[model samples]
Target: MTADLGARRASICPEPPFNALFNIRMPFIYPTSQLSLERKTPVVSTANVGQLAVDLIIASLSLQRVAILESGYCVPVVGAREDGQKGITTALELYGHPGVDFVVIQQRSPVLKVGAYSLVCLDARSALRLQSRKEEFIKALLNFIKDSKFGAVLFLSGVDLSNRTDSQMTTPTYQIRPENSPTLAGTALQRLSSLPIPKYTSPVSQEAQPAESSSSTPFIPGGGITRRILSSLPSEWSVPTASILQFVLEGDNRADAGLLASVVVKILGKEVPQWRQPGSWRDGLFGTPHDQTLFG
Candidate 1:
């Protein structure tokens, strides 16, 4: 699937302006408030563990919903609110407190992958549409960071634990910064370098490294679009971008989420508040206990 998607993507042209792609909706207005989004940071989470970590952050901080991003790139989804609110939630939304210096983007659905529907015998037009959606999504996100004048952007994701090498066994967390990042050196992001966490080393063999690796982008196995998204950001933009990665396997990851969230808070230089699990997690997050009677 990766190879197939790569081949299709190679022929595609660059993305157009973001205004032509999607519309952003901010339903709640704070007219009399002193809240300002300018120069604030944005913590963007990918699917899986990253999403879970963002969920923990939102609940812990008691952040408010700020915006709903409408994009065709993600698979359509709707579910009961994670915050135990009265309404349903969509695939993508933003949350933040006016007093906070950072906003969190919670992605509730995975981005559409053309390979998943390839076997469905999609027509050429349909295939093109799928590919465009992904490109537009990335472009829209990058454009948002630029338009909003964010101080910096942090991306979060999880890599496959099985891909870890001997050296990586020491720590479950790692980070990746764009090679020669112009904006990260003097910023708070620079503090991440002093932490115990090591820089992410791609597990891909030198011989089989993809073309993107030439630009010094880390290949993150099972990280879902993280590498792709980071690679898309040009260093000249100087947005002080960095990604925090956790090594993880499938199944219960609540503990992993908590640990990752702590690391993120440390990087952001924020006080770690008492942890609060989202209400949605109470709904059989670990699944129903096995019936003891069956063992008899």
Candidate 2:
């Protein structure tokens, strides 16, 4: 029998209630860590929280962003790859020279810039070694974002494309938000749909799923705690967010990055700069190394 997609969705990620509280629980078993919460703050410079000056923040919570950087170029890494935190200090790098001028925040997470947008190459894996420091790191990251006064935040995540199909569709996998429509949420979704990439359709086939499961909690699976942090931002903050998750077959994802970047630029009412074409991306290093490296 085909299990309903809504049923599978509810089992996977329940919708948070109107007055729901934050779920501080970690979903996976973490190895022991020596660092304490206080020690983690030094990685995040409280001095220049809003220095980015960009109007939008684009993030990848899948943690693959780390490997793409470790390879030194946008080329695909051969062998098995995975996601999640590596270590505390391992997570902090203020200035990175991985062929790109990516600014490290809170020690390990990296951020790059394109015109008015700030692309956050977040390694969700690093947060694992944080231990009791997770909450503190999240607070610091949020404060830094708040200081930026960005109009909106967009999280670009990757979902596993195993067992089933549609890996090459180029459609975004999931978008997280409250059940009821906020004006900004509606506007953001509408603008995002206007982008030229395909998006996931409701009611996936039942044979595609592994099995039925249940979870009372509502959350983003691969996103790690970053989703929780983004979801918990208070309403008064007025910074709307849209997380565009794409499906990948576990290799180089530069093509996915290009599709996501284009969607993001469109959502922000900006054009994909003419120089970002796939043909020129290899030589147009400043354009988008993330995408160019994959197909260029």
Candidate 3:
């Protein structure tokens, strides 16, 4: 069935756009003299051809990242605690059905949708492993850009605390953005800046004081593919926007992921009840630290 489908698609697919997009080259090989001469036509793999078509179809959808959450803590080899993934799951659960679905580019990555917004959870282990043969990955992403629409992409990941400078004080959340960005990207930055930090309220009195925030655009070391993918996407689509939140890698990364999700929710102008409180789970399997201190 797959072979038949491939053949039917081959008969109808146009050559120009696909050739240019996938960098497909056509070269025929020929052998020796008249008696021994053998002619061979260039062969294109059916799987590759099918994948391109699939990318085109999927990318054509109008999808936006009203809110996006990306995490790399739960990789295959690490088998370490998946703090980031768990955090995202918990946040989505708080908001009822988050449109749970999977869009398999290379591996079956999950996509959570809330109204017009989307939250994409990516695992860097498989993505980096597949980078060596990036034909499908790149083609799928490019097609997604060409077909769909994205308001802005928010990259969320944990960073190594040791990389912090003296000026920084504990688990600082840094925003990394390009010098010039698309409208959506710029909007993301604007919204984030405008969002009022959670304020402390006195029980007796009704006074509220805003929370403190730090500013820095430090390079995200050990960020895997999350940073690279978002940063390079704008160059491809022209109108796309992207931003990154590299939280300190120490302690409970699950809480870190939730913290990342909360920021996204706030920027979208949504209300989060008890947003500052740390997420608690009874498993105690990952051994995540209980400190949940978001600010210094």
TM-score of each: 0.79, 0.40, 0.41
- TM-score of model number 3: 0.41
What digit string (tens of lDDT, one per residue) describes model 1 on residues 48-140?
999999999999998877777763568998888765676677788878887788988889888776411121112222232334456567777
* lDDT (10s digit) by residue, model 2, range 79-189: 211222343223222321232212223222322111111122222211112123444445445654455443445545544545224453444544554322234444334
Candidate closest to the true structure, highest lDDT: 1
- How well is each residue in 217-293 modelled by candidate 3, as lDDT tens digits? 22344443433344345343543343434435444444454555455455545454543321223344255666767
User: Which pairs of residues clash in candidate 3, taking residues 3 or more apart in a chain or in different chains?
Assistant: 83-254
lDDT of 3: 0.33
> Which stretches of candidate 2 lie above 4 Å from their native place?
1-131, 163-170, 178-182, 185-190, 193-219, 273-296
lDDT of each: 0.77, 0.35, 0.33
| lDDT, residue 121, candidate 1 | 19
Model 3 steric clash total? 1
